[model samples]
Target chain A: MVDRIPILKMGKYLLLSIQVDMHDQLALDLQEDLTEQIVRHRAKGVLIDISSLEIVDSFIGRMLSHIANVSRILDAKVIVVGMQPAVAITLVELGLSLEGIATALNIEKGMRWLENSVNEDEIAGEPESDEDTDAPSETGN
Target chain B: MTKTQTLPLKQETDIVIIRQRVRKAAEEARLGLVSQTKIVTAASEIARNALIYGGGGQCLIELANRDGRAAVRLVIADQGPGIADIERALVDGYTSGSGLGLGLSGSRRLVDEFDLKSQPGAGTTVELWKWK
Candidate 1:
């Protein structure tokens, strides 16, 4: 059986940290799984941490773009984080600019960006509602 | 021009193996971080093309000297329905398959030397070389 990259649910967001050098099929599987998870959980944001990936070829680059695109259609914002400097240079040299995908330097920054974007969307989506003006409800008991 | 290793490009998982072997060879050649990454990424794109487009093939990793500088060379060959229009195939966003069509043109940009040979009924061979 092929190993799968696990997806964690954090409130209204889904987080996936790819910790392995994923084969092609594995990458496709992650895309399918994440899309399903987003719909099932009604996730508003997604964070894909690729810090462990040493290389990002055209196939993987396309996969990332596909994931971001699909997530956006499902109303979830996607943030890719922790790309190595060398990988960034190589992707550009390889002609894969990875356009349309939002990126951050690290997981912390990615989460913050996702949170802010989702919050901004909520605010923009409900400008006329006074009850939703204060802040998003905290996940507290 | 001593050949270091030869790997089969029959399956998708083999692409990962090819990337690992190429990376090791690049490190052995003492290439810097960015160059190593570039060569490895180039190897990956060409190797996949061999597997997907050229059907199934083999890759030979060779450690060579380019003007006395250490260099790593990868020769990926496949015996499948070969490409007839090499010029059009080299164009960016010109894929016969469902890829983003950056495999050939992008690989050429990443390496110091790129050579492609293909015969319609014979096969396709891509030679990628990067020097330290």
Candidate 2:
């Protein structure tokens, strides 16, 4: 049996902290399960905390991008948070820019970004702004 | 300079083992945390290639002295079908498999030294070292 990555619901957002190094199958399972969680919860935002993940290979890199894309289609905003400096360097060196994915230095910043975006969606009177934006800022902490 | 540990790369689970071994080797080599992280991440990428693309292989982690500097070296060899074009394979965003095409090139960029050797129907061997 494949171990399921836990998806915790926080208000209108879903939070997932990847503490263990993910196997290929586990990463795939997380992608599928997370999408389902987003749809089920009808969440407005997703915060993925990866501080505990020491390395992110191409597969995991693609999975993160895929999650962001799918969540967008499902009308949920996704914010990736807590990427280690080394992991970020390796990701860029690996050529997986994770372009079109929003990132934050920590969960606190991610929450703030999500809050502002949600407010912007409300203010601009747009459908949550599928504007393909980058991270609000790179604390790189 | 020649102390080394070997791990078989026959399955997916071996990836974690390889990473752990690389981490231990890096620690023994006295690399800084950032250096250790880079090497481990590089090892993870190459080990995955050994299992998925090469159809399983073996990895050797070594503590070596390069130009009188301490370094951790990782050698991954596979017996599967070899890559047809080495240059194209090393280019970023190029993959024959369904992956993101970041395995070879990405691993190369992460380490201080990278070497690749392969021939059709023979096999492939990748050597990487990060000096401390």
Candidate 3:
């Protein structure tokens, strides 16, 4: 199996590119890899681009949570980008992002979110970002 | 003896792998895709349930009754604490874990024949059959 995941260094942030087919356990590996990169680089932010994923299931959902959790511990903010509408709908239904994992329009937006978060954190001494920031409100839209 | 296979978790995602491998093996044995998908869905759902509620378990997919109808049997077993109440678990919408909880009951809806066994503090085993 070819590994379609890569970690690219752009300034202090790592743009982790993942093109996943049938995203199941593959997400787990990606989570682990991203966590390692966060620690190794002592980097400030992450941009995980998963636009190529076809299906997002429970495992992938869990992996995203895991990645966000670990990245926080490493003092690096994470921004998830390029989610398909189907995946977004399913995630809302499943309520995975009840813990605030940022989602931007694309990799650029994610990177900017992380960069801003990192800059803000450095100034304010890393206030708790608070979970559920990304959660869908009860409006049920 | 034919090599026995072990699956990671009884999950919808794993179902994709199960169907693909089962179909490949079935085609090697001359089985078609339509029947394979139906049966695998039923069996995979049961297996997936075992993973989530049973404290996580694996799916044991194997070939059985290569003679009669060339059927493949998948035994999704979990080592986690078993379901507290069997009958309630079978009831639709009785979800304890995450997602839709459509796996256990939905799996029952998919396969030709479904056999479910669970013992609290022990684990769970769901046997599903797909016939060609």
Give lDDT tens digits, candidate 3, residues B1-132.
Answer: 243477676454665665456555545434454455445445445545665567567766666664587667777788878878878877765678765555566556555677888788888888877666
RMSD of each: 6.1, 6.6, 8.9
Over 4 Å off, model 3: A22-25, A125-141, B1-14, B18-47, B50-84, B87-132
What DockQ do the predictions score, one after another?
0.84, 0.66, 0.10
What does candidate 1's lDDT look like per residue over B53-84, in tens digits? 88889999988889999999999999998999
> Per-residue lDDT of A1-141 in model 1, one digit per residue for the tens?
357999999999999999888889999999999999998998999999999999999999999999999998888899999999999999998899999999999999999999999899888864423354567568677
Tens digit of lDDT per residue, candidate 2, span B1-132?
Answer: 248888999988789888878888898899987888889988999888878888989999999999998899999999989889999999987989888888899889889999999999888899999999
Evaluate model 3 with DockQ and give the value: 0.10
The lDDT leader among the candidates is 1
Question: How well does each candidate superpose onto the true structure, as a TM-score?
Answer: 0.92, 0.90, 0.55
Candidate 2, residue A100: how far the Cα is off, in Å: 1.0
**Candidate 3 falls in which docking quality class?**
incorrect
Each model's C-alpha lDDT?
0.92, 0.88, 0.65
